[model samples]
Target: MAETALHNTTTSWSSDFKEITKMRLAISVVFSSVAGYFLGATVLDFVDVLLLAIGGYLMVGASNAYNQVIEKDLDALMDRTKNRPLPAKRMSVQMALFIATAFAISGVAVLYYINPKTAMFGALSILLYVLVYTPLKTKTPLAVFVGAFPGAIPFMLGWVAATNEFGIEPGTLFMIQFFWQFPHFWAIGWWLFDDYKKGGFAMLPTGKRDTKTAIQVILYTFWTVLISLVPAFGMTGRLYLTPIAAVIIGLLGVFMMYYAIMLYKKRTPKSAKQLMFASVSYITLLQIIYVLDKFIR
Candidate 1:
């Protein structure tokens, strides 16, 4: 009977690993890593691509796992996150800890096989997101700024992976993503203001979602558009943006700004939701344009 119980426990633990890590979300993060890889990879080979995706997924998967482990208690308080495996007790703390460490260590090892620099960056991203940003979320609004470092690195990590060095091309990808996070996150903050408050997360600039916060969102949105165009102006290193691609990317940003302005003016939940969706569409579309522009040019 003891052996039977032990076997059942091991099977249950395996199931919990799948749920606790939130593989779908981690895969989305991995996809962004791939997009970054594409933007920077001058020479594409199947082997390199496979290594990048696997390492990227493992790296991000580890970060997400660590996030849940640390925030398990807080997760129970947030409606949007309360159902996560950790908070729901679907996984024991020790089990989750082991999973997080395994993924993180293995991820770095995989990246190391790509190149030492890329591996370093991958490890740094995991450290920053988990060690720095995760804890800071409950402490201050500046967490967004700190978090952007890791968030932006994926775009450039690909560049470094391909080029084996950091240069203007990867820098441009990093800049656009860095600026983009502000508005993207603020919009979510606006929409989820109540939930964040309930969870004791200080996501918004002012903690209160109102005119002050809205104006900051607008400011960041403007910055995002402006920085995105720097590549087109042909001043940001070798990453030159053709006039046509610049105009198209600009127009997309304008569409996003229009929604942002609307949300600012109305400050309604629905409008915030619209802005959030627009932000998502904006970044994804922008990434598509960046990759597509390479072919067009």
Candidate 2:
């Protein structure tokens, strides 16, 4: 009986860790970073790629853990966040902080082993997410704007990891992800407007599910689409895309924009949800296209 009880306790802790770290989201972020690494790397090193993946995941996990700790009370107020480890009382704040600190230190150390610049960016992402964006969430609608800085870092971070330099190539990668977050997050905000209000979080640009917010989503989607094509024009240094790849990316952008427009016209929760899914697909496919073009072309 004691052994079984201990086993259950262990399993519970494992689940708590996963919830605090938001494992799936962290993995997705790691995917973007790996894709960026591939884009910037002319010579592939499997060891470096593995290190990048581990370090990137750890850093993202650390950021998420700290965010949960900071927002524990607010998280309990929202339906979407209420089941998280902190809000659910499955883990103590002290334990979460310990995990976060360990992950942050280990992630930065691993990244530093790769290169100093990579570690710097990883540390910066954590700081921005925790210190800046987390606090701003309850204060101003511009929290989304501040959050984008850290959200967009992983993609470019991978490029810096591979190239050990920050240039137009990584800058272009950063810009693409940076602009893409507006539409993606606004779609989430539109659908969850009620839930966010419960937490006193200012997520949407206009802090409401209105035409203005939808219009901003559309505008950002347009800009994201345009910036994505800059590489094809040979303006973004080593990040140039071929004509065919550019056409494909443009179509994907249009596909996402179509959902954005539908959200604007319909002004419904379902439309907002659809836009959110499309935006995710758009960004994931865009990264894939960039990496494939680099290798295949």
Candidate 3:
């Protein structure tokens, strides 16, 4: 009985850790950074790439864990967040803080070993997410605007990690992801507007999923699609995309924009949800396309 109880406790603890850290989101963030690394790497350093992945995941996970700690009370008020480790009481605040500190320190240390610039950006991303974005969520709708800075860092961080320099290539990558976040996040904000209101989170630009919000989503989606094709113009230094690859990406962007347009026209939760998924697909597939384009052509 004692051994069985111990095993059960261990399993529960693992589950709570995943919940508190949002491991899936952390991994996805790491994926973006890895894709950036591959695109920017002149010579493939597989070992360093692995280190970046570990460090990126740890830093992102730490940010997520810390966010949960700060928003424990607010999280309890929303259906989507109520079952998180902190709100569900599966993990104590002290434990969460300890985990956050461990991840943050170790992640930064590993990244510093890779390059100081990489480490600096990693630390900055965490600081901005925890200090700036978290607190601003309930304060104003502009929080999304503020949050986009750190949110877009991973795409550029990979380039910095590989090249240990900031240039047009990384800047272009940053701009692409920077513009992409608006429609992506706003679609989620549109669908979850009511749930966010329950927690007093003014996530949407207009604080409601109405015509204005939908129009903003459509406009941003257009901008995002346009910026995504910028590298194909051979203006972004090391980040050139062949015209064939450009056409493929353009088609994908149009597909994404089509969903965004549907959301604008219908302005329903269902449409918002479709746009949200479409946005995710757009970014993920876009990253893959960029990487493949680099090697194939």
Best by lDDT: 2
**Candidate 2 accuracy as TM-score:** 0.98
TM-score list, all predictions = 0.92, 0.98, 0.98
Q: How far out, in Å, is residue 143 in model 3? A: 0.6
Q: What are the RMSD figures for all models against the true structure?
A: 3.2, 1.0, 0.9
Off by over 4 Å in 1: 1-19
- lDDT for 276 in candidate 2 is 93
Candidate 2, which ten residues in sequence have the lowest lDDT sum? 202-211
TM-score, prediction 1: 0.92
Q: Per-residue CA lDDT of candidate 2, range 1-297, in tens?
A: 999999999999998899899999999999999999999998988898999999999999999999999999999999999999888998889999999999999999999999999999999999999999999999999999999999999899989999999999999999999999999998988888899999999988887888798899999999999999999998888898999999999999889999999999999989999999999999999999999999898
Clashing pairs in 3: none
- Write the number of the candidate with greater lDDT, choosing between 1 and 2: 2
User: Which lDDT values do the candidates have, in the order given?
Assistant: 0.85, 0.94, 0.93
Over 1-297, each residue of candidate 1 has an lDDT whose tens digit, in order, gives: 999999999987766666677777567666666777777767786688788888888888788888989999999999998877788887778878888899889989988988899999999999999999999999999999999899988878877877788877888888888988988888888888889888888988888778998898899999999988888877866566788888988999999999889988999878888998898888888877887887678
Pairs of colliding residues, candidate 2: none
Q: Per-residue lDDT of 1-297 in model 3, one digit per residue for the tens? A: 999999999999998988888989998999999999999999999999999999999999899999999999999999999988889998899999999999999999999999999999999999999999999999999999989999899999999999999999999999889989999889898888889999999889988878888888989999999999998888899899999989999999999999999998898889989998999999999999999999987
Candidate 1 vs candidate 3: the lDDT winner is 3
